[model samples]
Target: MHFDTRLFIFIIINIINVRPNFGQYSDDQSYLSSIEFNRGGSLTNLIFSSPHGGFLGANLTLKKLGKSLNNETLTTILWQLPVAGCYNDSLKQCVYTLKDCLQSNNKILSYHPDARCVIDRSSTLSMYLLTKAIAQSFVSHYHPYTILNKLTRQYVDPAEDLPRGTFLLESAIRAYIDYHRLIAIAKEAIRSPSRGLFIEFVFHRNSQTIQLGYGFDPLYPSTMGKPSESTMHELISRSGPSVIIGNNSLGYFLRLNGFEYVIPMEQSQQQRQIRYRLSTYSTRMHADQRFNAILFSYPIERLRKHSIDQEAKRIAKAIEQFIQTNNIKILSSFASSLLSVNRIMRLCVLFLSQSFTMLYISH
Candidate 1:
């Protein structure tokens, strides 16, 4: 019996063309239940992620060997429960670790007049609201992809490298994996032949300034900096540092909208004294030729209950103005066209392969 070369080629082509559905999560029930993933519209090229804002505790299970699954052991401080209290009456300063909190009769005591823990709840909520506001600011069909971790930082910090982030707990490890998988899926969805932006929302309580990190060193001059040194080096090289510190930059728009504490402005004094330069694992690892990454560090005050709405609107407006000025949306459209050209090329290749196979069979 003669081999059916045409049928084999067709089968190979179909298999090669098969790709994961970028719009949805894996069909596994456990994966679907692991984290929160908000799917974006096909027309939008924006993605936002909140890794530290989750407060849900993971119900962890140990392996048969009684060992944490990962190679790195858990930090000693992480083993102890976190506390929201001062270590002693004299200091009157609240700490994050239980070892630093006041202990009376073997019980950790809260010492601060207003007990508060280092959690990212406010930042998470603010990001969610800001995403909605941004979508509203755009046309009806455009929406951004969002991923939020539900497990608290105590159990999992998806923003960190795996071993430290999960502490080797089985459930926490699964959740961490799910969080990143969702981000990858979202990125794939919007990268219509490679062009998009990723924003990560982080929180800091020490200052009320809004820090925008582009993976630059905190000590580096924001205005007169070298583009090649940044994580968004490609973008900076193409658009110039002006995109970051020029009159039409995000910092400028934010300042124009009454946000006095925006950092990395053109020749701003705060650029030298105060800077976050949060070249986090997420931003460093995810930024590539396909998409540019930025970290938005918001102070707790901006996301407080009384001000979250107004702050979200202000941020949305600034972001909208920045995008318009930079023509980022136009770049996204160009990327879509590139994707179409790629698809047409792939179809032409398949047709040529089929025609060659048919000719061989006829001969």
Candidate 2:
């Protein structure tokens, strides 16, 4: 059998030269269908993430870390675990999968019942709907990249440190890595000389007010200080502190849109006692680079089914106004088109490479 050495080399070269298609959307089913990535049109430098909002459960049994707590206390302490199914009898343990519970005629309750399976409740139907709404709001003019984790937080918590997040589980580790990899790809898609913004959503039932975090100390003074000390230093250096807390700030816009309570108001107290700071493992790691990060924590009330659209629109508008006021340059249509072309070229190269390899093997 004769092998075409020249053709084989050429195919290998093409495969090596092809860059990853960062501009293309990714629904990576290979990693147990844990992550969903929505590629931006490259029109905007904004990236949104939901680390805790996930629902799908895995086969791995839930591990009880540290002291033992009852089902109600455990669910309450871990805000992400949603109620899957409930058992009426105290002697009977709840089942692992929602389907199993449903088949057994178990009741589905949010709290105060023995749950057989508990997934991340944070990604409730309303939150998912809100993400869609925000995506649509930016579709016409400025599109922002979005990354969501689909697996239940019970198995993997991508926002936490690897040890705590994955609990050394092989499957959980893979999902965690994929989650960050998707975010990194999204960032690459929007790579620019100017800094970008990363907004991560976390739902909290404790506070009615919307809290925007920039990695500052919860009690840090609201006044502008050393930019180098905060995670948003790059953004602060470019646009100054006013872009974050002035009349044209995102908080200001949220107020204009009828959100009554927002942290870091124009006339905030000398000591800002924020409850939730964007200091999560993932947020800190990402914010240390070319993107400014904000941990957006809002009351779960905002995610109510009836008002999610309105809530999302209001938040989207606030982000838009913030970008405009800060002079953050969005990618031009021409640049976005170039990215799309890059994706197509990469796909073609990969296809050709695979076909040639198969043909050579057959010989």
Candidate 3:
């Protein structure tokens, strides 16, 4: 046999063995179905996601979705700045082949070498956080963050409604459905006579404060307060917030952490309503009302310039302390050991560094 033929056969054999009956898939298809949904470790009642950290453009899919290749939101958020968004042509063109080879096919992989900074919570390192969280929780989804730039009606504004087939819009709807489903699954997991906490991790590129969203509305009329055991509102915020707290105790938590945060809701009723809607959905979504949620948002900016790993360790430590301080029981002994701040920091750093490495390789 020719040398090329032998090499080709070897490649084919390996691909078959690894994929197992999966044959002939486009990069986008492979990514959307498998690479995108990276659930590291086990199904714990914890999830860490960075939806916009994805560098692969799904250019073909986005084109079909009516997104332009040059949308500003896409640029600003994903390919915009030199520090965090997409930076060059290679990342603009999705390349996962090298990434797949590097990871050894055992884990989920996302590749975009030109863009390393997509914003945290909008992180490319969500999978790492998810993997780390699984050591403790019962179920989790660590997600990569990617944006479909031209899906919105306005190129510069992300707040505008996205037209159908727009990538981000599709992702948003999928997430909405997924979160509801996750909540349902988590409810069952939490109810099995096992004490568990549903922890969701998010990224916040615009702020320095790590906001722990518990769904308590301090301004909610006294007559209409969230339930003491409420994790429903908390879950909604975990999925994503309507508004970040700007003032009050929650705001104070940011200050305590040596970070700055804006309390938009504290100052304006309009902002409050905006946030309220962003955090909680209509009662029609029956699943959201039944459970409580515990979520935390980290600042992505810190990852770029500071030893934010120390801060991440601090957050993990705080959670451990919170659990012990309140006598919360975690089911797995493995989880108990993994809950240490040092371990969590290591896992978080590993994922972030790997994701960043994939981007730099393109340069």
Candidate 4:
């Protein structure tokens, strides 16, 4: 009897360990599904959002969305300024191959390499700061302290609708939804426990994505739009009344009925970029010269298409190793070792770096 009980306990542990590896999204394709939540009858709202991704131009009519060749822009770029953004010639021409690859591979590597300075500046690195900004709406308008004007501030926060004057930009939210909707939802025992928990999808792909890869992208839309959490502040601001604090503190989560504020937590989505760096320069994905190459590889577009791209293999190995090692699984289980909104926080760093680059470009 003792041996049988031990074997049953062993099987349960193995099942829990195996769960995260299965049922993930393919990067090549896109789909939609609903996420149900338990608010303990407190009326939890669902705000499907996508932040570090963009799929507005992607089409359902096409199996794999293909971007146009953009060498004209690159070749026209002055050598003095330096070139940016990946310009793939073959993928630009071969739609069929792109489709087939998307179906089989299920991942798109978004290759645009523009620094955050050229983009926007809100970051997700410091959870307290982001939450404080959400609580107070006093952070700089462009985020990570970029864009310090009324127009930019109003552009990010539409004070007319949400009172808190904070919102997750719908575009960014949709992108987050496009990739992570299938990933974030946990299963419900009250509704349909028999289906177990449905896993959220990861929108797998090796295509050119946005370059909010370091503490570089602070002005990326989601960070910018997070200020409008409550509908009441926007109302008070317009009514010619200052927002007053009722209690000693001033943080409130019940500020909106329909906003895309996610529960802040961190995860490692940059495993690909990190591994590529380790191989190319005995480097990591922090600020450096080789970091840009690992980012764009815009320099080596033709080299990536072949079946045996070292970068892809390296990325695959890192992911496989991340899976095989007990460390990541251990991190997932611990609460004290957590970083709030980990993936978004990493992207926040990427966005901030972009802001620095933007200032350089301006100078």
lDDT of 4 at 249: 8
TM-score of 1: 0.66
Q: Which candidate is the best by TM-score?
A: 2
Candidate 3: stretches off by over 4 Å: 1-31, 34-47, 54-191, 219-224, 228-291, 332-363
Total clashes for model 4: 79
Badly placed stretches (over 4 Å) of model 2 are 1-29, 54-123, 267-274, 333-363
Relative to the true structure, candidate 4 reaches a TM of 0.19
Q: Backbone collision count in every prediction?
A: 0, 3, 30, 79
**Compared with the true structure, what per-residue lDDT tens digits does model 2 show for residues 1-363?**
445677667755765655423445555455565566776653668888777554333332333432222322221122233345445355465544322222211222222324454544544545555665776688644677777765656567787666457644667777888878888877886755546888877656656788777666523454367666666777788777765677756788889878888876665454244445545667778885578887777777655543777888888888888778777677666766666567667766776777778778987
Write down the lDDT that model 1 would get.
Answer: 0.61
Two-way TM-score contest, 2 vs 4, winner: 2
Candidates 2 and 3: which is better by lDDT?
2
- For candidate 3, the C-alpha RMSD (Å) to the true structure equals 18.3
Worst lDDT window (10 residues) for model 1? Answer: 58-67
**Model 4 agreement with the true structure over 1-363: per-residue lDDT tens digits:** 012455446544554443212222333332221111111111111111111111111111232233434312111111121112222355542221222222111232222323321322232212222211221221121011110111122122221112111122333223334323232231111121111101011111233321111112212335323322222222222221111111110111111211111111122345223321111110111112211111111111223353223333332232223223211121232321232234345554665576567667777
Candidate 3, residues 255-346, lDDT tens digits: the string is 55545553433546754553311221212122244333344455656666655455554454444443443333433535434333334465
> CA lDDT, every prediction?
0.61, 0.64, 0.35, 0.22
Q: What's the candidate order when arranged by decreasing lDDT?
A: 2, 1, 3, 4
Off by over 4 Å in 1: 1-28, 31-34, 54-137, 192-194, 218-225, 268-270, 275-277, 305-307, 329-363
